[model samples]
Target: MRAIGKRLWMATLAAVLALAAAGCGSPASNGAGQGDANSGEPIVIKFSHVTTPDSPKGQAAEKFKELAEQKTNGRVKVEVFPSGQLYGDKEELEALQAGNVQMIAPSVTKLVGLNPAFQIVDMPFLFNSREAVLKFWDGELGQKLMKSLEPHGILGLAMWENGFKQFTNSKRPLKRPEDFKGLKFRTQAGKVLEAQFKALGAGAATIPFNETYVALQQGTVDGQENTFNNIDTQRYAEVQKYLTVSNHGRLDYVVLVNKSFWEGLPEDIRKALEEALKEATEFERQLAYELDQKSFENLKKAGMEVYELTEEDKEAFRKALEPVYAEFADVIGKEFIDGARALK
Candidate 1:
């Protein structure tokens, strides 16, 4: 009878231990998925870009990280590697597609390799104002552009503005299209941009954004074109002799994610991220406008010869680059170009 009682007590103790162990593990083990709110490990997103943290795109990335974490209640983590810490312009897209990083906000011009149709945005003077550019991007044309990337394993989430692009160079003032003659400028990788410089009888050197400063300092390239925010933040004004506020082209970024990784995320987590992006995008637009103005002022204070184009000056540039439209119509799709022009 004593042996029987001892055996029964041991069995009861083992049963109680098993139940307690199961309860303790249930909340974490039985969570929705790896990134579930109750899961022990949070979902990590590695976001990489080629601009400084104080730049418009950089600040917006941080804003997104903040909103994403708050909305997810710590279930999602966004790690932003700005200034090309992980990958430069030439490599970031490949890294995203290969899942090396989960997110990138590259210039739309950088995506010309993915879909030549993207160059439609690079057309000089195609968008008369930033508002028109945003409207076109938020409409059917933008949706169509984003849809074209799915086959390449890329998913476009949103379009963030970096204000209009201006011309900066070490050579001469760029008040007129004629001023660009005999000058070599560092341009992003896109035919339209190359053609724009070519039309002006200038040479185009395709250099990475991070390398533009060194390229200018070493005289590898005479100059480059970028927004005021980019020029001021990157300190291009210090290296270049001239800054032209032509607003000839729009410099914007397309937010991208790996298609497979995005679709595989928990539905709730995806919702949280989308909400975060929407709010961050709104925040970025206003911030971009403010930064552009502030940076313009800073550039003037930096003592670089700054020239703002008059209406007549822009018209001359517009006329000179008309051939670029015809040259790239087939490559970018005539309808896409037509649609974007219609917006203006």
Candidate 2:
């Protein structure tokens, strides 16, 4: 644990003990999963996320909550903290690694910080379509990436969705390469994004996802980029006026639990949770897709300027980002980059 986090934990436990002494809720086993439940105790879990309640990840989490309750016969409870209420991606990830938090849904792009090998998933324009993105992650490479987290004391559940990302701003429509110049943009706290934006001539800063809506609203940035689902659901459209269909970045949101928590669960509960996550992932993906398309229309209805790029319009972006491929060659490696391009 980080030095401050350790102190906070000690303080929190002390406060909780004081509360219990005053006849508050009871404390059970120190371990995470079924161990506490099997003894007729309710195991309440904190599930953290950075997206709004309407994003694919949020829907999946809600479904997981329903299924978990039914499967555990109300023995397990999942309390969701969306919009970074529990912690931001990197911090929540670290907390989960230390078992300070039970679960989180950080962008795969963020995981690259822990293991550079995961950067392969963040190469812009690498995924031709959402179909391709799904295939690659469900195949060998994705499972291999999951194993990467095991060593850090986190366990991977199925991925929900990050709808393909687009650009939105207040300064101007992103019609050409020069239009994006001198623009200050917000990106998720990922090195890959810094390179991606820098390649496009934008001044980019890594910011926590929770702060983005307010940042866009308050004019702290000229523009920011995200999926349609995020902008519409988080009400980013209420603050910003332009939407550009960049489709340049595809995202994957993974569910991770404390490794010890998952391992200690009963086999039956584990299987049910796995089944629930998969079912919810697919359902949320469909809902996000419907919303992603409808958000453009919704934004239009709400008096926003929206632009869908022609191939020529996208050509400029593709060309501008070409250098990013080479710039990250060492981090992601040419072989893996090529493998992704060849995915079809």
Per-model TM-score versus the true fold = 0.82, 0.79
RMSD of 1: 5.2
Q: Which candidate leads the pack in TM-score?
A: 1
Q: How far is candidate 2 from the true structure (C-alpha RMSD, Å)?
A: 11.0
Error of 1 at 178 (Å): 2.4
Alpha-carbon shift of residue 180 in model 1 (angstroms): 2.4
Clashing pairs for model 2 are: none
Q: Write the per-residue lDDT of candidate 1 for residues 1-344, one digit (tens) a residue.
A: 99999999999999999999999877442112334445677888899998889877899999999999999989888899999899988899999898888899998878888788888877887777777788888888898999899999999999998888889988888888888889899998877888999999999999977798999999999989888888988899879988888878888899999898888777898999999999999999999999899999999999999888898988898899889988988998988777777775
- Candidate 2 C-alpha lDDT tens digits along 1-344: 69999999999999988987867445346464323644666676778887778666787788888887787778778788887887875588887877767878887776776668677656777777787777767877777778778888887776667678888998788888888888899887667788887888888877666798888877788788788767777788788888888787876677788988888766877777777777777887788788788886887887778888787977777788888877888877676667667776
Give the range of the ten consecutive residues with the poorest summed lDDT in model 1.
27-36
**Candidate 2, residue 301: lDDT:** 88
- Counting clashing residue pairs in each candidate, in order, gives 0, 0
Q: What overall lDDT, based on C-alpha atoms, would model 1 receive against the true structure? A: 0.87
